[model samples]
Target: MVPASSEATPRKRTTYTDEFKRTTVARLHSGEQSATDLAIELGIRRNMLYKWSDKIEKQAPDKELRAPGRPATDELSEIEKLRRELAKTQEELAILKKFDAYLTRLKK
Candidate 1:
């Protein structure tokens, strides 16, 4: 008869909390130290640090404490307003280009 041995499975990766992510991003943006060095000190990968930085920049918020679930109705309205502004700006740009073309033709 042979003795049976149990095998250990790989452990799941642990995710950093929102507060930790915010603190790390702040340290990186402080301009007082190198990101790679800070990453090593914090025992996190440089790639992860960069990913977190990108997320923070795109989100443009220090924290996402907006309660659980979908965004608030007001937040959706703000997003729609920004979209409308962008469309208006694009239209104005197109009109300016047409006016410039007309002026160039007149000059010629």
Candidate 2:
């Protein structure tokens, strides 16, 4: 059995404000410094900074919507709706072609 003194203590979790996250992400996007170096300077984890950057990009209004992390349920439903509409349109087009071929046969 291990001694009680040998057990490691857990580190506390830190929360950053939205403004801090936005400015940090913007600085990273500017390419003035590497993420590793910036994270060290800011005293935050590199992976955390990357997550903030991704979140900021996803929130931009003019940017194309991307699937960040798992897609939301609403987005999944919209994609399903589009798929159904495309399938129905393709079926209708095929029927119209067959009808046109039948009409041509009658004319000949």
Each candidate's lDDT (Cα)? Answer: 0.77, 0.81
Against the true structure, whose lDDT is highest? 2
Clashing pairs in 1: none
Taking all chains together, the TM-score of candidate 1 against the true structure is 0.48
Rate residue 45 of model 2 by lDDT.
Answer: 88
Candidate 2 residues lying further than 4 Å off, grouped into runs, are 62-108
Candidate 1 regions exceeding 4 Å error are: 1-9, 61-108
Candidate 2 displacement at residue 98 in angstroms: 25
In candidate 2, how many Å is residue 49 off?
1.3
Tens digits of per-residue lDDT for model 2, 1-108: 889999989988998899898888878766798999999999998999889877876676543333234355566799999999999999999999999999999999
Kindly list the per-residue Cα lDDT of model 1 for residues 1-106, writing each as its tens digit: 5445555568789899978987887787775778889988998888998788667655654334222343555677999999999999999999999999999999
Q: For every model shown, what is its TM-score relative to the native structure?
A: 0.48, 0.54
* lDDT: worst 10-residue window of model 2: 62-71
Q: Candidate 2 at 57: error in angstroms?
A: 0.8
lDDT of 2 at 88: 100
**Model 2, backbone clash pairs (residues 3+ apart or across chains), number:** 0
Q: What is the Cα-based lDDT of residue 98 in candidate 1?
A: 100
